[model samples]
Target: MNAKKHSTLDHALDNYSTADFLLSDHFVNHQLEPTPETALLWETWLAGNPPNRHEWDRAVYLLESIRLGLSHYAGQVISEEAIEALLARIRETNRQYSVPVRSIGRVRWMAAAVVLVLSGLLAYWWHGRHDSESYYAERMAGLQSKYTERVNRSRAVETIVLSDSSVVRLAPGSRISFNPSWDGASRVVYLSGEADFEVTRDIRKPFLVYANEVVTRVLGTQFTVRAFDAEGKVLVNVKSGQVSVSKDDVPEKGNVQDASGLLLLPNQQAVFSRRSEEFSKSIVSEPRVIGVENEMPSFEYDAVPVTRVIGDLEKAYGISILYNREQLKNCELSASLKTETFEEKLRVICTTINADYQKLDGQVVIHGGECR
Candidate 1:
């Protein structure tokens, strides 16, 4: 809020992804488990800058997709050529996620590498027709508007079940107002403060949350959105599935519906930058597996290639493992561990393999000597 805080934030964001966002430690932390401090930091960043939200969302989806795709090879021995081939496959998959031939006719990517159309462009496109603001706002206007608004002024989280059975855990001091339009056209809610949503999947109707200018849209997923007015920021953290985020601006040119805005995957967070009117993506401060039911392992590797060990670790925790395969390809490890934490697992692995792993700019990065 102060000039100093804004200046510090700008510097951090400016240097944000000085390397690839996917490769950064921020991504790694979010991929693993983000601490409350980390989540708040990102929330502050996103809620401050609104314009950059879309980019953050798309990157989250892409990064998570790539990580999942790579996890399939956990049991296999990865050679240099095999790794290259896998990278090629990743590229191909990315192309698939991108816009294909613009089915809407007027909505085409401005650049080949641009993952999602910016909300500015989308605002322009949607301002003409299919204006979600006018459509939903008009629908909610006058006595004809039928909506339910809930405000939580108490000290405990309020769990509210919507008409469609979608559940929202409204944080204390937060408010959420929604229309029982499930049988109608769109399921939209206006939110303030922070709340976690366990949204029921509805193919026919998409769940949309509007807080200030930031919009978080999803079909069915578990995620948290923080958009407190006093904070001057909007933030979305996806626990499962993908969530779309956009600013409230309706530009005069491009179609808003045509723009993807931000597409967020599990463990990723998007910060809306009000200072610069841009959205930035970061990993949650502490990211845990979406479902706690997944069996956490007591890993034991015997004379296995370092790659295999790392691969198994990645799979076990559902997080990305970045390492210098050239340095570790020939190395082998023999370790028996039980009741160790995720970090402890890595520490033992690294010790046995003569490697060092750490959170590098929010990613798990490892480097070490050859075992041979």
Candidate 2:
């Protein structure tokens, strides 16, 4: 945390992003258990800081919608009648106003609430439930989805191809599940442990990976998601193309502003801290060439400037390398990097140029004193 963030308690209430507030431990704890002290803190905070009121309301509404959706998703039938009634009344209002129902799904309307009362956080009986409630509620009631599961428990990687020709490299002790017969808007897969996905191109049907509490969305991209039980965190790293990863609690289409987690380009990674419900993003520590086993690129350079070497690497790995060009403009390097990994190449180049490299949000930033 920076000094600005660390001093937020005595500073402005709305200094943080909406996501920071939504995913904070304090907010979630207060939402889940608003004891007298918690209630006092939030109520007093909300009353004093008028600017934060809107964000507070949004956070609450988002949490409620997510709780409801997850309840339905996990086959928990707690307040179906009340929630449905609420949806019905909202739909009726939309009809009166002549509002077109969004073709997206029920999750959209879930953000609507005429009344601003916080829905009680109630636990459910997960005794014998075995299906995604919201996903199957409308479809299964009308016979629209067919699903299957694939698990790899051996000490070797397993390749599983989906009906859409999307390829999955399922790591040992991992499971990748989806409908065997696919006829849906998107190719949805529930993953546990780690798996590398090479999705087939179908912009009409984007691919979605649900791992732990984070949802990774991509269209015809290659990426990797890791959410093993022992890790207690979700990690998403994009190999090529773009990928959007957001927490399940936050609205997928968060308002008109797109205020959520992040959209990662190649070599970017997002890590979700389960305990704090916070997201931390950075460049991948070691990005490799995106290709099959036999198609890795070769790297060779002879007395080349650092710029040329890094440029070749950037093209090979599909990741951005940022640096002060003038500082290292005169630096030269001569090395064969074909056998080295992405990080190895970076280290070699940095050492040769007497420079240092750090992975920033989604790019590698080079730092060095002026080369003599």
Candidate 3:
């Protein structure tokens, strides 16, 4: 690819969020439903470099609100024709959906807060291990020698230093099976699930990943591998560097050339089908978004308005937001969610709004008539 294109791709990949991946998945599944107006808004918002946090939160809030509203109003009973018309008017004017609210007591709030904080720390520690190349390389080699032990739910997270210094964070629920006595020119591992890899550069010892019939070769790079057993499809998302992906024959004919793979650059993805023995590549953005750079403000609130707090909850958790009283939007809420459950989080928000939460048909609804 040209330098300009490569640069643009890198920027998009590094700053990718869960929403972008969802959007791509829509296209991949052939379920794209974006209207021209929505597309234009997305383009305009994404064109800006590192968009403002408040505006970014608002955009996510609006999109989710609309999505939820559509789902709710699709099949609901209304009193009179005028009430139906009024509902339509409200929907058109709001252009957003109200997220369902679930109640949580003080105890639940405390427990959830603890989990969230600890999860963040664990994620950070995993990244630190990936930064040390030598550590992970040795660990990787040791694990390869011990492959094929056939242990159920045998989970291990290792940060190995490759021959060169680079880091890779392997997520949980990943397993590898290989020969203990195997020492070939190429370093290889058989993947059964998902794992993130940060490889060190050594033109001599190329890193090879085997997922079912597909093989991914990389000299040095950071990427993720997802081999779904149910669907029998494999995916590789490259964060940096380059990789060559291909398919091979079944184990019965050891090491037979099945089909040639495709070369992928940074911010690109490759998908392979075991049955069809076909691989396709396309551009993909990164997976994480909020709090990525530490430059954006954290989800901290101190007596903040209820509407703004609800907006934050929707962005952080990727869920629907709802409210019955418009006056509650101005109610003040002071709470932290560094650790909390969905129920607890809602209670905190509800407490400030002085409202009650109810669940109706798997959806939460806030029904108090007064606020403040």
Which stretches of candidate 2 lie above 4 Å from their native place?
Answer: 1-145, 153-156, 250-259, 291-299
lDDT of 1 by residue, 20-107 (tens): 3332334334533557666555544554453445655655645433333333233354455774575455455434433323231233
Q: Give the TM-score of candidate 2.
A: 0.55
TM-score of each: 0.55, 0.55, 0.37
Worst 10 residues of 1 by lDDT: 1-10
lDDT of 3 at 356: 63
lDDT of 2 by residue, 1-372 (tens): 222222223334555444334434456556555575665456445534546667766666556444444445445444656665654554344333332223323532343332222232222222123445332222234432366778898999999988899999999988766877666666777777899999998877778787767788887888999976434357898888888888765322212124377989887899886646779787775577765546544567777777888887777777788998888888887889888878778878888877766665677778783556
Please report the TM-score between candidate 1 and the true structure. Answer: 0.55
lDDT of 1 at 291: 38
Candidate scoring better on lDDT of 1 and 2: 2
Output the number of the lDDT-best candidate: 2
Clashing pairs in 2: 73-133
